[model samples]
Structures are given as C-alpha cells and as structure tokens.
Target chain A: MLRPWMRCSKNWRAMWNNFKSKFLGTNFKRFMGFVKKEFYHIFRDKRSMFILFGMPIAQILLFGFAITNEIKNVNIGILDKSKDSETIHITNRISSSPYFKIKNIVSSEQQIEAIFKKGQVKAVLVFEKDFGKNLKSTNLANVQIISDATDPNTANTVTNYIQSILQDYQREINLGIPGREPIEVRSRMFYNPELKGVFNFLPGVMTVILMLVSAMMTSISIAREKEQGTMEVLLVSPLKPLQVIIGKVFPYIFLSIINAIVILLLGFVVFGMPVQGSYFLLALETVLFILCALSLGILISIISKTQQTAMMISLMGLMLPIILLSGFIFPVSSMPWPLQAISNIIPAKWYNLILKGVMIKGVGLRFLWKETLILLGMTVFFIVLSIKKYKIRLE
Target chain B: MQALRDITFEVKPGELFGLIGPDGAGKTTLFRILTTLLFADEGTASVAGMDVVGDYRDIRKAVGYMPGRFSLYQDLSVEENLDFFATIFGTTVEENYDLIKDIYIQIEPFKKRRVVALSGGMKQKLALSCALIHKPKVLFLDEPTTGVDPVSRREFWDMLKRLNSTGITVLVSTPYMDEAELCNRIALIQEGELLVVDSPENIVANHTDSLYKVAAKNTYMLIKDLKDFKGNKSVYAFGEFIHYTHSNSDFSEERLGEYLEAKGHEDIKIVKARAGIEDVFMALSEKKGTEV
Candidate 1:
C-alpha cells in the first residue's frame, strides 16, 4: 500500500508541474502586460495618485487627532472675592493644570455672569468670600463651576475636570491632619475608559479609507474607461470579461493593501495603538474586507455609464452607509430594530467588529469566527452578484 | 428607437468598402453589431465566417474595431498602448511589428508621450496602429477623421489606402462625401437606411437625371428663382453653384438659362455637369424621403 501511494503522488506532481508551465507560458505574459498598463494609467493621473496614497495617511492623521480626550487650553473666568493665600493657591493649581486657562478675574459675583455673557470664557469658577477662613474652621468649603452649555458634551468634560482638580486640592491641604484616612475615593476606568487612546477611532478611519480607495476609486476608474471609449476597444479584443476585470482591479488591490499597511503603521507609531492579537489574522481579515469592497466596486462600474455617475453612486450611495450604519460611530445595539437589521447586511459593520476584536479586545479567531464568517459570506455574495451583472457586450 | 432597419451590405475579402453617409445615419450602430460589441434584436450576422451571436468570442478575435471616438487609454504612452493591445491578443509587438511599422513609424518620435498630449491626427494614427497591432483579417474604422485638420485627414486616408493595398479588407465609414470616391465600393446611407451600394463609378454613373450646374453673380437669387421654376425636379447648392435637374429628360440648359433671364437674373451660366457621389447621395436620399 505504501509503494502504490508513493507512485500515485509522483504522477500527480508531474501533472501539476505540466499544468503550471502551460498556464504560465502565454496567459501570464498577457496578464502581466495588462497589469503594467493599469499601473501606468494610475501613476500618471495626479488626482488618482492623491486619492490612492495620500488620502489614507491624511484621513488617519486627521481622525487620530480629532477624537483624543485631551482637552487643552480651555478658557475660564475666575471670581475670587476672598483675598487670602489659600484662595490664591487654589487658583494657581487650576491655572497650572493643562485643562484650564484663566482669561480674566472678577471682584464681584455679578461680574462672573458678565464675563460669561461677553463670551470671554467657556467656563467660570466662583469662590465664596472668606473661603480660606471657613475651610480652616469648618473643614469644608464650596466652589461653583458654571460652564457654557452650548456644546453640552464639552461643558460636561470641562466641569468634571474642574471638580476633580478642586477635590485634589482639598486632599492636599488636609494631609497634615493625623489619624485620618481622608476617605479617598480612587476611580479606575477599565480598558481605556478615559478615552485618551486613539484605538477607538483607528478601525473606523481605516474602514472609511479602504472603502474610499478600494471601492470608489476602482469603480470610477472602470467607468472612466467606458466614458472615454477605451472599454469598447477592450471588449472587442480577445480578452475575456473576467480577464478584463481582473486586469483593471489588479493595481487597486495592491494599492489598497499598501493603504491598509500604512494605516496600521500610523495607528501604531503616531497613535501608540497596538494590535493585541495576531497580525497575520488581522491581515487576512483585512484582505477579505477589501475583496468585498472591490466586488461592490465592480458591480457599481457595471451599472454606471460614466465616471461621474460612478463617483456619485460610490460616495453618496456606498460611503454614507458605511460611515453611518457600520457601527463605526454609532453602536448598532442602540439603533432601531429595522436599521439594525439593515446594518447586518453591510460588510463594514462585521469588519469593524473583527478589527476591534483582534486589535483592541485581543481576541483570537475563535472569538471572532461569526463576524469573519459574515464577512466571508458577504464577499462571496458580492462577487457572485458582480459576475452575474457583468455585461459581455454593450446594450 | 430603431437605430437601423433592413440595413444590409457585404464586403469582399480584398476590397475596400466605405459606408458613406452624414451624421445620424446609423453607421456606428452597424459597426457595433458586426464587431460583437452589440447584439441585433432581429437579424443574425457573422464576421469572418463566425456567427456574431453564437461565436462572438471568435468574432472578437478575428476583427479589429476603432470606434467613432478616440477610445484608447489617454493616460498611457503610445508604446505602452500598442504593447498592451498586442499582448492581450497573445502576440508580442515585435512579432507583428511588420504589420504596423508603416503607420507606427510616423508616431515613433513621440512614442514616449502620453496619448492626451498627442495632436488630433497623431491620436488617430496611434489608434489605428493599436487596432492593427494584432493583424486582424478585417478592420472597422468608424469616422476616423471627424475632428482632424485637412493635412492630417489626407495623411490618415493615405494610410488606410496603403493598408487596403496590402490585402487587408477595410470597412470605413465617413460623413465626408469626397472620401467616398477613394474606396473600391461604397454604400450611400441616410436615416438608418441604405440608399444604394455599388462601385464609386457606378454610383455616380447610375444617377439617371440630367444634372445642370447653374451659376450667376447673385447666387442666392439663382437658387430662389430655380426653386420657383416648375420643370426642375430638385435644386441643391453644390459648392459655388446650384445643381438643378429637370422633370423631363430632354430639358436643355439653354431653356433653363432663358428661364433665369426672364426672372431678371443677369450673367447666368448653365452647363451639363457630370454627377459625383455627393450628387448621387443627395438625389438618392431625397428619393428615399419621398418613397417613405
């Protein structure tokens, strides 16, 4: 039995080598030439060049800086009626912190409201008269933090930061007392709850860039051929429809992969956001999502007649849904049931989950098999639909 | 939107055929149907002995098509476009360089330049070279000289004539009637219908009516007075003179000159003129309009 199996293996190996040589002879040259032409086309166009490489880096950097929780140089007005060392010390501490910048000081309580009304400050700190004396005698004092509510989210963060600074001052002043624990309340935010890390936005920006370059660019380029009449020449040539499509998308696939690598590097270096899981698995999943987007691009190009229509449909039709309903910004669980059901159909939604899971959650394939399967399923569905929609001849 | 109806013609293997018509005459539609880029809703056609519908893949491999528009990749350099077309047909440019060398040599100096930087005539030449790189049995050129200057258009036609002489059957369409005289055979088309198909000599020779070229100092009044005349069947402005044909076969130029004199026209000239393809096309289309 062992001898027969060895003989069969040798025969199969010879057949495989023969098949490889035949296909690699003529078809390989044709395919490589086609790919080279596509590369020249993309490299020579300045707009396409900007979209391909420049867009990913610009988008990643902009989003990385936008979402970090660091609130620096927030202007504020202080009303200090108490002329004492303790009041001055607390004011010095608030100004020293990076979060607040004191723009003005008011001697009267009425002037505090005037500063806010004048828009001279985003927030105001008011201290009561004789604060130092009251704290020394009663062991308690009050400070009021009034913030502008025009932007409620920033106001909340500003007020929360001021309260914590005041509490810190209270703890520092009470340290000399003996036989007291001071009732310390230490709060720890788990898994980057401080929102200081750029990890939360990394996946969202990567999805948007990949979708824009991979899907929108590919669709518009193919439609450009149609508009310019080059597609008619291609159709009349000996190239098969599948070969034509592969030739057109080969350069985009390479560029999209490079774009993904650039985004990951920026996330790691500029943002210090690391992938906690295996890099190999992340790359494989990324390739899967790119395939899905490319297939969608092919479908769009088939239906569109010109580059303008392709660009319009890709941006207004595909990009909007990926940004809005992919849970990249808003959580899917919080969405209504109908929208949640629709979101399940979007590949970016599943890919976003997989990106977060592998990069932030440190989960392996076993934990993310469902999302991976959904993405894989979407890839196949889009590819098959694109093939069915591909037209061999102009109508 | 029936773009064509009952449009039929055939080209011999070695003869150069021209589809002569004006714009909107459905020449491009027929070219598309033959090149396997479109499907006919009612009729069946074959290209080089292969059915366009059933054996479309073979038809595509057999014929080379240059659309009415300049359709090559404008961003790709001239050499790159040629090499790309050659490779896709599984043949290297060097292998078929003999076929395209005559045409490609003119644009060789600018082979490194992108197609967008090329002039209208050079772009047309490059397009033709790319179409011929594979050395197809038949070539379809649709309005190849629509936007070129006079010198370039003449050079472009000279190349086509040379290609035809080399035993490559050429099916070219043009809105310019003068180019019709250069082909071995021609088809007069208008309004999605074929008016007639014959050799250039036969088309003009077949014009039955006796045509007279009428000239006067006041060209506008000459046409007006002729249209007002009763015996003339058709009056058209052909170049600097008005070509008029009468209803009766024996109507003389002297009689027409006398009629113009009565209409207060001075220094009138009328002579029996030999008909050309343009004269035949106009008459045939006007006849077709009346029949319809």
Candidate 2:
C-alpha cells in the first residue's frame, strides 16, 4: 500500500530505532559493562579476594578437626563395688584400650553422678558387687556402661567401642569353657567407609564458600554504592534497576566460579578428598547454587539501607543455618523433627544435599532433581521479593 | 499542587543558573526530578526539551549531573574514571577533547592515580571533567563547592564561567550566598519553597532598607546594645561590625554614637555599607518566614 521510497524511509527509521535500543538497551553488552565495573571493585581489593579463597580452606580444616566419628581416649570413671580378680581384669581390659581413659576409680554409687556433673568424665563403667559366684554358677556376667549423652555422636561412638571390648573379653573367657557355639554380629560402615573427617567437611566448606562469595560479597558491593552515593548516580542513569542488578551480580558470579575452582582444588590436593561424580555436573550445580545465593544477596540489599546492616544480615541469616542445618557435618535423619522441618527452609540444606549427592554418591539428575527444583524455586522467589521491595522503595 | 509546584525556569544557552538554599529546601528534590532520578507526584519536567520520564535516555546522554556530594568512582584511577564515564556516553575524550581539556589537563599528571588519593580541589576538578567529558548540552552541578577551600571555590567558579563560554548550560546549586553572585540568575529557596528568582545584582539592588554598619571598641557589646535600642529595626553581626537598620532615618551617625556612648560604649563608628546577597536573603526569608 506504500510507495517504495516511503517504505525504504520507514524501514530506515525502524532500523535506526532498533539500533539505538539495542546499542543502549539493557543488553548483554551494556550489562557486561556494569558487570566489568563490579569486577574492578572486587579485584582491586586484595583482602576480599583473600577472604573469598582462604575462608573455604580454613573452614574446611576447622570443621574437619571438630567433627570425627572415631573415639579416642574418652575419659571415664569406674565404680567398682566388687574388688574381685574378674572385675579387675574387666576394668583393665576397658582401661588398657585406647578408646577409654580411666580418670577415676570411684568406690561409691553417689560419686558416679558427681563425676558426670563435674564434666570430667564422659562415661562410667560400673561393675556390680557379686564376689564371682554368679559367673561360676550361671556362666554369664553383666557389666553396665553409663555414658554422657550431651554429645550424642560421642556417646554413640563410646558405646560401640566399649561393646567391642566386652565382646573380645567374653570370647577369651568363653574359650576357657569350650564346646559352646558363639553368635557373632558383624558391622560394616557405609558411604564413608574410612569415616574421614575431611569427607564430611568438604561439602560444608562448599556451601559456606558459595554463600560468602555469592551472597555476602554481592550485598556488600551493592551497599557500598549506597554508601559512596554512586547508587544515586547509576539510578539516575537510563539503566533499569534490573539492568543494574544484573550488572552488579555478573562479576560476582564469575568470582564465585573462580572460588569454587579454588575450593575444589584445595579439597583434592590438601585434603586428598575425591569428587566421585562428574566434574561438569559439580560445576553446573555450583553455578546454580551461586545464582540462588546472589538472588538472596539482592533480596538482602533491598531490605537493608546500609553496608553494616547487609553484612550483619548475611552473617546472622546465612552462616548459622549453613553450618547447623545443611546436614554438612551432622546427619539430617538423626536430627529432631522440629530441627528437620527448619532445615528444609534453608537453601544451604538443599545445596549440601546436592553436593553430597554428586561428589560423594555420584548420583545422576534423577537423584538431585528435587533439590535442583527447590533451589530454582528459591532463586525465583528471592528475585521476586527483591523486585517487589525495590519497587516499593522506588514508589 | 505538584511536589515541586511545577518549577518552570530556563537557563539560556551558555548561561550559569544557581538554585540557592539550605538543606531540605527542595533544591535537591528538584535537581533529582530534573535529572530523571525521580518523577514528580504531578506535572512534568524536561531537560533539553525532552520529557524527563519519556525521553530519559536521550536526556541522560545530554546532561552531566554532579550530585550534592562529591560522587565519582573513587576506586577507579582518575584517568580510568574519566574514560569510563566517557565510554558510557558512547564517546571518547578525544572526540570532546576541547570541552574538558582545560580542566582535565590540570589533573592529567595524576590521571593514573586513584581518585580517593586526590585532594578535595583535585577531586572537584576531576568530577567536573567527567561531567564535561561527554560534551553535554547541559551540566547540572549540585552544591559543587560546598566543602572546598576559598581558593578552590574561586577556581571552580572560574572553571564554570569558562565552561559557560562554550555555549553549554550550567545549572548549579549552593547555600553560599557569595556564590549566588557568580550566576546569571538564581532562585532563592527555603523549606521546599521557591521564594524569589532574579539576578544577584538585581536582588541586592531591590533591598528595601537603608543599611548601616555600626561598630565600637567592644563589637559584641555594641551588637547586644543595638538590639535593645528602641529605634533599632533589625541588627545582625557581620564581620568586624554590626549591620543595623533603623526604625526611622531621622537619626544621624552622631546620634547613633551618642546612643552607644549612653549605653556605656566607646570608640563608636556608624557608616552606610553596600548590601550583599545574604542581606537580601535574610530580608526576603524573614518576610516569607514559617510559610513553607
């Protein structure tokens, strides 16, 4: 319906409009410029870079030292009512083993509770008074092991050690009275057969490092703009808030990737921990986790007015949950129902699961689908909340 | 009423305009609205005749805004900072070389140095250079000379005047009344309200009262005694003297000296002095008091 020249002019106008919008519009190139600026801030500060890399290694070593299933030299108080040779032999067997340290030989039942109250002893091995008559007639004797349940893992390990010692002692005594068939129970540890502490701590380190690099660092960067008054300048620019946030987060994403590589390398070289699954899958999951953390950081930045508030929010809101509820060091199944319910809300819990699933179990997408879906949903929810808050502030 | 009450003023091409006020006088609110950082609750504003909200991208490309505080990328080197802002506007320093060359060449030696390490005067110069790097149609500097030394302040104004000669609109805001004289026109604002808008000389020429400077051996005592005098209309302490306007002009300098002598004063001097923008500001603000 239009003349050829007119159509050409219209098309030319269209092309100019398109060029202007694309060149200046919230595009990858423009956003990349903003992101490059953010990287400049991060790379310029050597302290933050050090924290991003060094914290993971330091935390991994700390958690590794703090958590161990192996029981060694557990302090104990023995309450022996009978001073018989058989009872003394049993006490010697218990004390001679590396697992139990005989801190006290209390002669009274009342002292048993005091020893535990003072916190000097973890368990009390009690031998009831019998004069050896019961063992001679019944061919069986009982030794009771009472343990402090404050730390259930320690208590559980100590019980297992004492039981194994008792079984060995019983076998030696039973051999003297032959013609008896003994029933033996065998146990095999699963997942972490050697029960290396580093294995347990590596996943936790990954969760913490991802959170610090992706959430805390990003929040601080955004808040720094608010502090320096540059945020106002950027806001006044033609760039949309989404474009600005994307720019701010892009560099952090790259930094987190580098951080992940460093942590994986440290876990492999220093700790000698292996990633049983595909490295590609681990890297992919790490990137997804970083996205979730960055969304959370943006959400925090939207809520906080200053850098101090952002830092505090990140520390209190993210650190404890990542350590306690992520099933990083503790088994989630062993936790109470209320704690288990609370852990489900923390993103780090899902991330820890994904890390363990991939790095330890070598599972496929089928095993990590639910966790991945939850992380994606959290990312979306955080982003939506931040946008809503930012809009409210703008209004 | 609009949040800014439909502020409508135009800076002639290559002219310098000042919006003078204290904090919370709606000076910044207006600057923000004009810069496209905020939208008014009602009415509209534009820069370079492009609607602030609709044509913000073009407006942004056209204007260089220096906020009330010195806000540049302090982490970046002075040179990198200039280059970054220049690139954002899709131009190079070489393209608009002459625009900011005068200001940039001063700090050019420290170009590779971080902006944070620069002195306040140097920082101000760098900020102005970045604003001018894009060769903007209009430059908005909000309180650009607030905390600088008197020498730096004078130098900054000289730079602004030079920039104005290049046919670029320069709009600045400051609470300093002396700086108001440097502008072609200024709007006096108080408590989110614009009281008066006119040239600095015109505002001073329009001062309603005959002002006099009275001093004695004890200046503070003289000021206190003058306030209590029945004939004294208004008395404010100026440098080295007390500026007093009388209720009536029937009294002469001899009478003022006699009055001060009666009030236990000596070495009295009373002489007529030229009124400044601050005097006019005090008079106009007092006349419009408690209304904002």
**Root-mean-square deviation of each candidate, in angstroms?**
3.4, 6.8
Estimate, for each residue in B131-201, the C-alpha lDDT of model 1 and write its tens digit.
Answer: 99888899999999898899988988899999998889999999999999889999988878899999999
Clashing pairs in 2: none
Model 2 CA deviation exceeding 4 Å by range = A1-32, A72-152, A168-179, A329-339, A391-395, B1-8, B228-232, B247-258, B290-292
Q: Candidate 1 - CAPRI tier?
A: high
lDDT of 1 by residue, A25-75 (tens): 666777888888889888988999998888888888888787555688999
Tell me the TM-score of model 2. Answer: 0.84
Best by TM-score: 1
Query: Per-residue lDDT tens digits of candidate 2, residues B1-292?
Result: 3445546666677779999988767888888888887877877777888998888777877898898888889788998788767665667679998988888899999989999899999999998998888788999999999899999999999999999988899999998988998999998887676778898889888886888988889888887888888787779987887888877878677787788899888888889988888777776787777344
TM-score of every candidate relative to the true structure:
0.92, 0.84
Clash tally, candidates in order: 0, 0
